[model samples]
Target: MAILRRQFAAALAVTGLGVGLAGCAVSQDRAGSTPVGVADSLYWNGPILTMNDAQPQVEAVAVRAGRIVAAGTRADVARWQGSTTQVVDLQGRTLIPGFVDPHSHLGGVGLQAIAANLLPPPDGPNTGIAQLQETLRRYINTSPDVRELQVAFGFGYDDSQLSERRHPTRDELDAVSTTLPIVAIHQSGHFAALNSKALERAGITAQTPDPQGGVIRRRAGSREPDGVLEENAYFGALQHLMPRLTVEQSVGWLEKSQALYLQFGYTTVQDGRADPGGVDTAIAAAKMGKLKVDVVSYPDILTMGEGRFMQGPYYSRNYQQHFRIGGVKLTLDGSPQGKTAWLTQPYLQPPAGQPASYAGYGVMSNAQATAQIEKAFANNWQILVHANGDAAIDQMIQGVQAARARYDSAGTLQDRRPVLIHGQTLRRDQVDKIKALGIFPSLFPMHTYYWGDWHRSSVLGDPRAQNISPTGWVLAQGMRFTTHHDAPVVLPSSIRVLDATVNRTTRSGQVLGPEHRVSPWIALQAMTLWPAWQHFEAEHKGSIEVGKLADLVVLSGNPLTVPHAQLIDLKVLQTIKEGVVVYQAP
Candidate 1:
């Protein structure tokens, strides 16, 4: 440490840093530490876009002990340059604060990785059941883990993309292997299909009554289970199917997920809807010192009990070595693209089993959900409810209003920063209510890029479909909102998130809503600064300003100056967390 300090001093003198360069070596206590001294590192010579509106841009940033000490023109921050200070030459590249994706499933990413890939273009090429089966068979044949488990587990099956234009049936999956239990989860993560053998294991039978808030799609006429499960039924089935992963195994999966997130320039990620077991695994990983990226988890309000929610030791908002239990995650309904979200208007084209008037069903009764919300608030936990359907949003609105009235009727609203997750089908009036109530919205607008056409033609007719995420509506009200890719539901691609937010373009080269499109700068803010604010970490994160954590990323090109089409092609050149490089492109 002494030698390093000497080097820092000598380097500062040699670099001709003006004014008291030697004084930088004298560290001070809390009351009076010279803010702009010889920095441990400096990044200069590029477009440094700080999301801070005060000093929107800076040429150089100096870091001391993992916190920014200087951010200004090259000459202004040059005094921090020293021999020991690692200087990073940006070489005309672009630098912004590291992307903060508030609504993702980092832990789920590992689970998704272990399963067979059944997604459509860009990730996998399974456009039909044949390709899906091929991919499953390939995973079974190649993955020794699958062979040992004696079950074929796959995820990311999208009926919307299927050539058959429907979910694969049990008989089709039985074709994979009649003896082995097979389960293929839908891309929405709200549904799953089980083969005959898997169904028998989960005890879903012809006589078994449909669980409340969930469905077991039956075969043509009779009550024979068709093996497809939605909402709570899917979660119930998964409770039976998911194996007991060891702590080490869970850590390995988290590490794998972290590596992928780091590549995408994610310093902070989320495990949005961690079940109790998932939360345990995350805590175990944190205690063992295995976490590399910050993970804020929200255990499902339904799956976990009040006792657990009230007494769980992992339920703190503070960073406990890269892990924190943000709050409780409640799912009010299913995905809009799956034609299962509880919408006010009927779906343009309902799925096979439902009537034309079928709008979707809530995953829980209003009484049950409101009870959970009341309990969560009673315990002082921040609530981030998942309400993709407009009706579900209504549930959230009523529930939150009642909770606030019951608990803090003095107009405080608990100051909990209650969140409305997804809100894909959120209405404009709800936008006003959300703003008035001080609820934060972490919206999923990538639906425009991934499922816009499907939403327009089948899930929701044109008018409603065009407003899926409605980020622009929130902006119009002068309310702040954040955007996300909801990793595992989709690959948490940062550029793709930004691109979709900025363009609102569907895959078919059509703009879903031109007015809904935000600027590239606003899109960047959604990913960086705004999400930080949503998570209540804006002070230390969100911007490249002095005294904040030097968590930043360098891109191959500036997102602000890029053409819309080329935004998706931009690469993350380097990712720095607390001024230390964590990832760099090959």
Candidate 2:
């Protein structure tokens, strides 16, 4: 490897491609480049998308020691060709920048891997309470060491998609396993339905007081726990029984999630929120050299309280040791599909006990939110605020304004790269406010494909549903924004994300937000360059440049050239992070 680096450096010098390191100088163009006898890897691809505008396309790229040394036509990069160079001919495949998933939950990903697949159609076939019960039983019977676990756990149950059109009750889960505790979380991850055993083991009962921003659904006509928990209450109950979403719990599962993300061409994954245990696990992994793809976590301010979490070596501009706490996360509202998003307008269909005009509630008061944002800003921490509804977005904008007032000494908001997560029901004016506030909306366009029909007929009511992510509007402002799968809300598939973004097609094949659909090129930017910019790592990882790390993805088909309907058909042939191939298709 050492000798290979020296040769790669020498070739880079001769090619006038040296960015920082020094060596030899030969020709400025590929025609006159020298053929050195060394290179770690040489990919003579048909189309290498160097996101760099100056060189939008390249025929080949060469890497040494995880950094791009040269990128040009096959002949130019061939100059760097050496006896040891591992040459690869990307046969008509499209190679672009590796995806940077700016907003996702690594812990959630791990959990999804470890738990049972109780998700409804698309991710799983269980769409009814009976199927959910059967799935739980199957998971328990199949778990390798189920007896050793504290309890049986299943995840990804969606009330909206279930044939019953509602969440399962405690008694229903009890039928699966009455002797052992059982808990299945909703697809939203903000709610859960526990069996009677689980509720008893978790000490959740009719007498348990609801946490400030949560609810415990009660049995009718009496104060008895119904096993349904919402928001903080659900998470709180889960903390005791399921354990916090820590890396410790994710032992083998973390790697599974990494491989899954890599399969989707994600070279960089974000853990959007982490508790104290997750923080420890990440730090330990970083110290032990266990992280593969870069995992950027934003410890939840609400979860670990303030400053008590994965207290970083503060922060790093790079993915140090494969892990780092890039920022702080705050959840101001719940999921939109779950009907818990704090919307200004009521849901088209309210919950059982709520009035027809029932909009969801906020987790914190305006003052509390402002203070948290101000505190994070004062400490110079990047902020990621989850706001799914228009009301939630409004709250975030106000909080950001307040934080700016308190921290902006020059009377201008610094480029802190604060991210407004979800932005599902944001209005046009709220978007303008987000831009003016200098916030990046890491919106979830996946909703279009996963719940567009649901949103139209149930949640947002027609027109509002059509504009869930509003990608086109963000593009209209000539400002860059990022999009995400928001897994484990939806499964993490960048192709699906790209497809939903470019198509906005619903399950019923209706175009949800035709006006909000963005072009494939713009959608790709959101997944790559825009997300890298959002995470403050654009200088190093966003694009394929001479100095940038050779983080690339080879797709089975070119997303840009593919027909709009066939975008999701694109597959990940390979994923390379820092010049190292982390995953490859079989």
Candidate 3:
């Protein structure tokens, strides 16, 4: 690997090809001093997984001016070769279209980059409450920024995987800090635990009533908040406790987040839920020429309803400096792993302080949700709804149906491509409705690996658990669904997304839903082709074909031919965006 890196680097240096980000100098002109029919780069000598159904694999692909100029046999494409062209020898590796994110928060993933990691095994070291506390303490002690902020925030802690199998108490967090405020967000991001001082900082008290669609988990048999907040309660507290970042810090975090995505071979990513402020920050980053890969942001519809940002140049399908406001986002419910996702059926074991008949509740009433959807449709804005549980999915369906009925007289509302994110508990009956209504389902099947056991034993139990995400039913209906990592909930690891989508393997080595598992080829399409269509970018971004943007990823192994159990072992060796090498493995 070291020798390969040195050789690649030496070759680039000799060819005068500077390896940097999107802003780096590269020859893009086809009519200037450069030859008209010449290629800038050529990739060949290994497997090429083109997501396009026609000519799925090719012997060679040629790129020039950030577009694929030719893709065919080596003998056929060699005509485009020129003296200055930089040839990339695959050396038995695999090349595929760059991944297009279906759902995730790049801004939240940026925040995750700066905060202490509290995720459990395979991602982080927080396997128990003690380890979590220790991790926070270490972060606070080591991070100068956290000390300056005077509030220590940690992300991705899952109570289900902890030794105690419960959220850390205020007292437990207090053990780490009493003077400095502390906030620990649940792995699902729907829940959070705050120390007493942090709770005070957020102004939560015993007298405070639970907010609508949210819960303040209290002490046993008492009204006193136990530091745990769910849904709206957590969202509110988080807003109050979040530290403000300077422009430089915000842009730096965005770059760091993009770097993480690039490392995992994502050339196009989604900021699935963005606020006005986040959109502004992304614009600033783009203006500074800092973005290497394309970023599509879906601002929260509840906050910005057909706002001025939608009227800007950044709102178009074509990226302005690699950033655009693709659409609006609406979140209907919370996370299933946290037991707060609105569900039609009662939870098998309710969280503490909830009744046995407790099924999670939606963030808004059906009328309110429908009105928002109507507003989105009225403006012809594409909308993405975050719905996890079946009940939430029901409300989403109702909202879409109402909106389409009112505004789709020409039968063209389907062209808007409304998306349903994280349909983890989608019912078999709802599959046909989703297909009929043109709801693009962007599911997080990675939940199978991250929280499959918890859902089986605590959240839903038995048969209900086996059908989570329900990829098979969508396939059965001859429909395509996109899969996502929902980053910050999980790292934006593309290989893990592929592995979980294809295997449905849990942390305990159990195949959670054998029936829902897909072939590696199908999984590739979900991450690449289907998601590109989801983002309205299929024409230029999905597959490796002539005239498409040269957005591609080089992998250590071929996904289709790799042993089923060894998918996780595959690595992203290099990420190329628009014929330029943006990220190469070190």
Candidate 4:
């Protein structure tokens, strides 16, 4: 892998070319010197939200060699325009910095695209258990990939959204296919429902004990397997059932995934928890020039550890062919909507067959979590931990506190920028500690739209549900945090993210937490500027500023001026990465 990385770098140096639109040239440097060429593109006559506090708005912007050379009034930007420049008239649309994904799985998004979409309303057609089964059957019969893989796989089925108000059982999936091993993943990505064949193939029997930090759910009052696997159990079974994809297949998924992001106006995306195969796929795709947007992958620290790949040339802030390994990801708990997040307080309504005291469970022991965190600190690697519940958040906070105490004198702890991903159940007290520890909060406020009603009634209950994703609390502490879609949990729709962050409205039309609502401007900053800083790329990629990469998005409506309720109606007209139009809405 080291040799391969070195060769990739050498090839990039030899090519002396930039990853830009055809017939255009861009410098690889973030803030490169002026090229001899005239402006490649000149954009004006639109609302430009710079996201740069120094210059919150601009009238015109000029792009030369993929960097913003001029951004100000029309006269100032027109200075760089030439006969060859492509003058773009925005025609009253809104132009803003391209969306940056703070925490999401790029590869998983691709997988979600190819898998049978078992999601509910507004995303997929899986309205009930019967619909989910029928969808899988259709995929098995029609998708060549499924036929080739010989396993019927589906994703994004939320029991809470289904008409039946429950997960499809082993027998239910058997109706789809008894011979083929079928796997249906929960929308949370924390659980899986496998058919009987899949269980048999995975060697999961009625006698199989639940794995540590995971659960193999049983039939009502019986030891018989019920086809549901939670947390580690689901992860392990998935590893066994999922077939390895060919390089071509992996590249195809990468292409499709980025296209999805482009349509959503995201130019800088993330592969939040990449495995070895995922890293390899990304590298191969980069070498093939398959990546259009900036892809920053954070390999799983617990499994991948500080291997040679972690120490490779790709592990830097700079992009190598539009891809780089930003840091490492640590998942301390499961999803809150799945009722699997490790919470301090007992769940208001636990999963079936569980005690009233159930508050889910942690993925690892406190000692284990601290050791992993300390190791990252010792290695000077920025860590992003997925902690949704307050108990999990507590574990992360205590772990960081311990590591900081040990590494502070050595200077390894300074400006490390540790991130807390998906702080859905984060307590107000924990917010202060996070701010004090300098741990960046990359929150998931979109939950207010997708699962707020479920949370209010079943998961966290009333006041606690209202506090999920708590953006207002972070602001009260004078801290900045980023918001995310956690794509595949839902589509990577930046508009939906903005709407949920700004409105905090539930599916039932009630405001889940009016106190936690933020202005659209603040939401935009969280998506663009704050997330870029979280990934340590704020110097060049986040806002629209001179000497920064010309990464911008065009929207049909100005988010700042649009009626608050109509925010979700805003459409992505175009997505530009480094001055190149990657996606223009049809």
Candidate 5:
């Protein structure tokens, strides 16, 4: 790759910015004389953590029109400052390249914006039926839009703690909202609890059998279906009822989500799932120049009909300026927490009386997955498949291998780099397979922190539990890796992800799978350079190099030196996109 050094400086000079700090101190010349070119903005006086290997640290940087002009000593950058250039004195803060989240549901974040203030039931083990009922009651009674269906989300209930040791039944939700439809999505997004009204509105009844790739939980001792919906079944019912919200309605939410990401130091995000309408919305926002963050949208292949979505990176002429449609996304399996992750082994303890069904199976047949991937590869499309269980990961790898054999026969598959998103339960053998096939794993190691305790106690049990989110194993296997929060599934916070990867701490403060923890620098790369490489944008983004995009986040403290547990609390003091300050902390 050809690295252009100081191209931005030349461009800035052409734009009439002078080539020295003296020009910055002087006023514009009169008589219609155009001034010389220089820097548009300068940032100095900080520990600049450039991800670039050549120049890992710098005292200052110069930017001109959204790209880095120069990155070197303060004096070197000062030469690029012109009359109108904006200067930011970092006051010795720590600055790093803006974070890039490899996998997230951006549209879901937009949806959260619509009802952000509406508190959902408490999450995790402490969430009881009584507490949930009270929270829902309060939302129903006090929210201004009570007449509308009360749709509360983000609820987590430990199967071990519930009185029934099962999801809240439709009857329980019916007790709260018979007149209105209520859908409470599980925290994992694998299951949901819908009221009877919602069930009826979706036309689901006791007679309806589980769909091919999903399940409908039925009440015990009765033929009636309960409110709990699993896997694609929940998605099917909800997809039908989800409002066809207009693009205008989505803007507010999108902006809210963007702000949250910026506050957490993210500049670019790969939206893992996007509907056609959602893509159009993002594109429209970009076209209108309203988008503050760079978003790479991948259409949801499952919802868009398999084999139909665009296969590889499809960029706009101004992709770096705003938005781009990068690839197609697929879900190979369901959530492990919900006991639907398509594992080879059965759950050690299946719910009482329910026959030990293997923790479900792949959403797509192996042959079908292979066919889909082959077609996508032929079309030069990058593919990202969500595979959370060992079985699912194996199946996905087999499909990818088949695709490589067929479409990559000449050893020139192009750098499509099909990704195994959320390779959370990867097996040792599969790591070599992934490396051989040139596939990347965008691991969700944050699971180790968010659900580590539950994973230890209930989900994976002892033997398999320790293997969750094996970051150290991935690196040792010589495979490139990226990590993400899958935001809206979890908030899009790189600090949280960094902490989880570096510390491997559970919610209860116990360090789980200590061997899996990686160093802070490696974890940072997973969130930044690795993701950029996965998206094929490393040439222009990711690191803080001379020619890279001037996207950065100024932090209150150096993340590398902060206490591991306090990493999550690291405040993003300012977020700069293309050298323009987009967010500033109060």
Candidate 6:
């Protein structure tokens, strides 16, 4: 999707590009070019979305060093053009501020890339076990590089879709690989199906009891555990059997992931959960100056041990240009669709014949979760908790409130904007409380499209299902919000999330909840500016204005002008960060 010249012309007029540039250039040139010791970079002939209300549009932007020097018309920036300056002509493309993904698991995404690739369930109808097995066989056989540990991904096996309406058991996975261990991660990332060998390798057996905050599905007649592992149980068991990648290997995968982010027009990414190794890898990349995209690493608070270096004022000034230790991430609950998320009320319907009374709750105890939050708060670290269900949200709110009360009494409550990531199923009453606490909600609205149908039937039922993201409701409550794809959890594409937000259409082409749908403008802000605010980088990034970082994405069409469904198809022509062209389409 090449940028069309017509779009630029429209933006040029709105931005007063020609007039502003001509005036600025004449004024600057008359004053003589004094060596300011700062190099200049200029981008011209493009439609620029400033994201700033005072000056909403611009035709060109000039950058000095790494900050925007001026934003106006092509002529206005021409005066800054010197022999040492780097100039890029966007040729009438639509340029908007670079996207900031508020929530993403960078290491998980890299791991998925290293794992097997399986075909997703067919678009129209469900492919039964026989068909699915054949497809899996083909993928395994064709991809010879996928060795004995034949772990394949991308299986969207909803219960209703299957004739048996049950999770594929260890016996079924044995058909694929007996000697080698195999694990098929569900789309929701909350559940995973492991083969018998894989389970045995992790020392899980028929006598093994379910761990707290996690479940191991068991057969009805026998005490033998089914292959299905839910929540932390799945992660815990899998962590044992999974092969560990070396630091170099991890860095390679991260580099590949960063390239993909750049292709999608992201300049900054918040690593939603970072293990110690992952944090080390990020630091290594930053130190070597190999990181192309800006990174904010949020270390996983769950793994912190006593007397260990936990929270950080650990700033590397040399790497500060592209990397920062932003905060700590704590996952309080799992996904709602997976039925593992702790909710205030029981699920609408139990899985198949299971009694409604048997619906599960969140994995972590309230005390344990609260302690983690309090410790992070005490250490002056920003906290981002992943809480999806209303019950989980309630717990999170309680934790935040308690922490605030404790800190305030000691006169140590500096305004820390602790965020609740994926507050998807929050209750109406909790909305005001979130605003009052200054706790930002990073809404995962993309779920409305990906699992809307499943949610309508199995998970949330009808009433609460429609209120999933509640973008409109959140706005009405005056709560700040940011939206994300949670990359690798899904593909990291803001366009897809925007399409889902505006269109509200399911994979089956049905619009689920029209009431919760937000306008294009609001959706755009949630992806761009709101995310910057969540990360406390609003002052430097998020918007296009003087003194801000020059990070922008040039597109083929104005997202506002395009039809809702067409937003996903809009092409990115170029991506610029710190006034340098980071990516450009041929």
C-alpha lDDT values of all predictions: 0.83, 0.81, 0.88, 0.87, 0.74, 0.73
Each prediction's TM-score against the native?
A: 0.93, 0.92, 0.94, 0.93, 0.89, 0.88
CA error at residue 227 for candidate 1, angstroms: 2.2
**Residue pair clashes in candidate 6:** 17-73, 21-75, 21-76, 213-363
Span of ten consecutive residues with least summed lDDT in model 2: 16-25
lDDT of 4 by residue, 288-386 (tens): 999999999999996684466688889998999999998899999998889999999999999888899999999999999999999889888899999
lDDT of 3 by residue, 1-586 (tens): 3433343444334323355321122323122222348888877668998988889999878899999999887656656656666666666789999998888899999889888999998889988999999999999999986977788989999999998999999999999999999999898888999999999999999999999889998999889999999999998898889888888888998999999999999999999879887898999999999999999999998777448888989989899999999989999999898888999999999987689999988999999999988988999899999999999999999999999999988656458999999999999999999898989899989999998988899999989899999999999999999999999899999999999999999888999979999999999999999999999999998899899999999888998888999999999988999988889887
Q: Provide the lDDT at 462 for model 6.
A: 79
Sorting all predicted structures by TM-score, with the top scorer first, yields: 3, 4, 1, 2, 5, 6
493 in model 3: Cα distance from truth in Å? 0.3
Q: Which ten residues in a row have the lowest lDDT in candidate 3?
A: 22-31
Off by over 4 Å in 2: 1-33, 243-249, 305-311
Model 4 weakest lDDT span, ten residues long: 23-32
Looking at model 2, residue 377 earns an lDDT score of 91
* Model 3 misplaced stretches (Cα beyond 4 Å): 1-36, 410-413
What tens digits encode model 5's per-residue C-alpha lDDT throughout 77-191? 7667665666555656888999988999888776654432222222232346665566566667766434443454333444444555567778887787787777766667778
Q: With candidate 2 superimposed using the best TM-score fit, by how many Å does residue 412's alpha carbon deviate from the native? A: 2.7
Taking the tens digit of each residue's C-alpha lDDT, what string does model 1 give over 1-586?
3443443344334342221111122221111223346787776667999988888899878899989999997666766765456655566788899999889887788878778988998789999999999998889889876875677789898999899988888989999888888899898888899999999888889998888888889999999988788887888887777777777877787788888899999988888878777788888888998876788888887778654744766677678878888788888888888877898888899899789999998988899889988887888888899999999999998888878888886846568889899999889899999888778999998999889988888888878989988988999999889999888899888988999999988889899988789988898888999988888889889899888988888888988888988899998877888877788676
User: Which tens-of-lDDT digit does each residue in 90-119 have in candidate 6?
Assistant: 555677899888999776676666555432
Error of 6 at 329 (Å): 1.5
> Residue 215 error for model 5, in Å?
0.5
Ranking by lDDT: 3, 4, 1, 2, 5, 6
Segments in model 1 whose C-alpha atoms lie over 4 Å from true places:
1-36, 309-313
How many clashing residue pairs appear in each of the predictions shown? 1, 4, 0, 0, 11, 4
